[model samples]
Target: MAQPLEPAERRPANHGPKVAARNRDALIVAAREIYATHGLDAPLSAIARRAGVGQGVLYRHFPDRTAVAIAVLEENVRQVEQAAAAEDAAFADVLGVLTWHLTESAAFLGLLHANGATGHTEALAHALVLSGRVESALRRLLPEGHRLSAPDGLMLAVAMVSGAVGGPTREVREHRAVAAWRLLGVEVGPVRPFEG
Candidate 1:
C-alpha cells in the first residue's frame, strides 16, 4: 500500500508574510487555471490542491467559492480600469484589452451571469458594479459627440466580445472589435491585438 502523506506535507509552508502572500497569489492563479479548464463548478478542494495549499489556507483567503469568483472578477476589472485610465489610450485599444481579459475569463463570466438570475444577490451586485465601472471608463474614452449611450455601447461591445471568446484567430477578434466600434458610431481603423 502507498504511504499516507503527513499533515505538513499536505499543506503549504507557513513561513511568514512572504509565504502567505505567495499562497494567496498562488490560489488566485490556480483558481483561474482550474476554472478555465473545468469551469465554475470545479470543487474548492481542487483549487486548494492546485495551489499547493490546504483547505484551511483557502478558507482563510476566501470564505467561499463566491468570494474566490468575486476576487477573480475584481482582478479582471482592475486591469481594464488601468488600461482605460491610460493617457494615450484609444477606444480600440481599450476594447481590445477588455476583450482579451473577457476571453480569458469567459468561464467566470458565465458563472456570474448564471448566478445573477439564480438568487445570488451579492455576486449579481458585484457583477453590476464591475460592469458599471467598465461602462464609465468607456464613456470617458469616447470621442466627443458620440451617438450611443455608454451603457448601450458597452452592452453591444460586451456581447460581441463574449461571442468571440472561443474564436481561434486574431483576425476574428479584431473583426469583432471593429464591429463593436461601428455599433457605437465610431469608424475606427484596424485594431491591434491586445498584448496582455
Candidate 2:
C-alpha cells in the first residue's frame, strides 16, 4: 500500500492590529536602511524583502515610498524631542541629534524639497513643528548678541544642515553641519563620531 498523504501546515493571517503595527515598524526600520544605502528611489520591494515581509504587507502599511519616508522622519523627530527634553541638553546637543539623522539618512530632507514631491506639505509641516521647538531652545541657550533675531532662524539652520547632506562622506557631512552652526554664530563643541 502507498503511504498516507499528510495535510499542509497553515500560517496565520497578517491582518490583526498587532501584526499590522509590528509590520509597519519593521518596514520603517528597513526603509531607513534601504534608503540610506540606495537613496529614496530604491525599490519598495527591496524594503519589503529587508523587513522579511510580503509586498502586500508593505503596501498595507505605507501605501507608497513617501509614506515610508515620512514615518522615518517622524521617528527622527521623536528622537530629537527626546534629546531636547533631557535636563542638561543644549541647543548644540539637539543639533547633534539632527546631524546624526542627516548623515544616516541623507536623502530624507531632500524628499521635502524635491520638485513635484508628493508629501511636501506634510513633511514641511512636520519639520516646522521641530523647527519651532529648536527655535525656542536656540533662544534659551544662545548668547544675547548671537541669538537669531528672526522667527525663521532655526529653519535657516535646518536649511544649512539640509545643504550639508550632499557632502561626499558621513564625516564631511558632520563637518558641514558644524560649519553651518559656526556660520549661524553658534559653536557645537565637537563633532560626534559617526557610529553608522
Candidate 3:
C-alpha cells in the first residue's frame, strides 16, 4: 500500500513571497534568453515555459511583452551602471559594456525603437530614465578632449550601435557594433562578460 500523504500543516509552506520572487526572477532570465533567441515578438507562453513557470505566474509579474522587455532593459542598465562603478573605468570600457549589451540583447534596442515609433510613453519614459542614469555615469567617464557632451555621447552611442548592428547573426552584430564605435572615434576596449 502507498504511504499516506503528510498533513498540510506538516509540510513546508510552498507559496509565499519567496516563491513569488523566484518565479519572477526566473521569468526575467527566461525572457532574456527567449527574446535573444526568438526575437522580441516571440510568444509569451514560450517565456513562461522556458522559465519553468506557469502562465499565471508570468502574467502576475509582467502583464505583457512590453513589460517583460522593460524588465530586461532595467537589468541591462544595471549592468552598465556596475561597469561604470569601477574605480578606473574608462569611457571606452563603458562603451564596451553598452556595446556588449546592445549586441547580445538587440531586443532591448528594438523594443525601444518600436515603442518610440508607436508613441508608447511608458517604455520610452522608462528608457529615458535609465538613459539619464547612464548619462550621469558618462559625465565622469568621458575622456578628456572628447568633443561630445555626456548626453550627446550617450545618444550617439545608442543610435550608432543600434543602426550598425542590425545583422541577423550575433557575430555580425558584434563586428558591426565595433566598427560603429571605431567610426565614431571611440576605441572600445574588450567587453566584460555578462554576469547575468
Candidate 1 similarity to native, TM-score: 0.72
Which has the greatest TM-score? 3
Q: Give per-residue lDDT, candidate 2, residue 111.
A: 66
Ranking of all predicted structures according to lDDT, beginning with the best and ending with the worst = 3, 2, 1
Clash pairs for candidate 3 = none
Candidate lDDT values, in order = 0.70, 0.71, 0.79
TM-scores of the models, in the given order?
0.72, 0.72, 0.82
Off by over 4 Å in 3: 1-15, 193-196
lDDT of 3 by residue, 18-69 (tens): 6998898898889877887788788999999999888988999999877988
Give per-residue lDDT, candidate 3, residue 68.
89
Estimate, for each residue in 1-196, the C-alpha lDDT of model 1 and write its tens digit.
9987788767866586668888987898788768776777789999999999899999999998888888877877777778778787786677667766665565665655565665456766898888888788877887775654554755665665565454434445456655655655555433432334
Ranking of predictions according to TM-score = 3, 2, 1
Candidate 1's C-alpha lDDT?
0.70
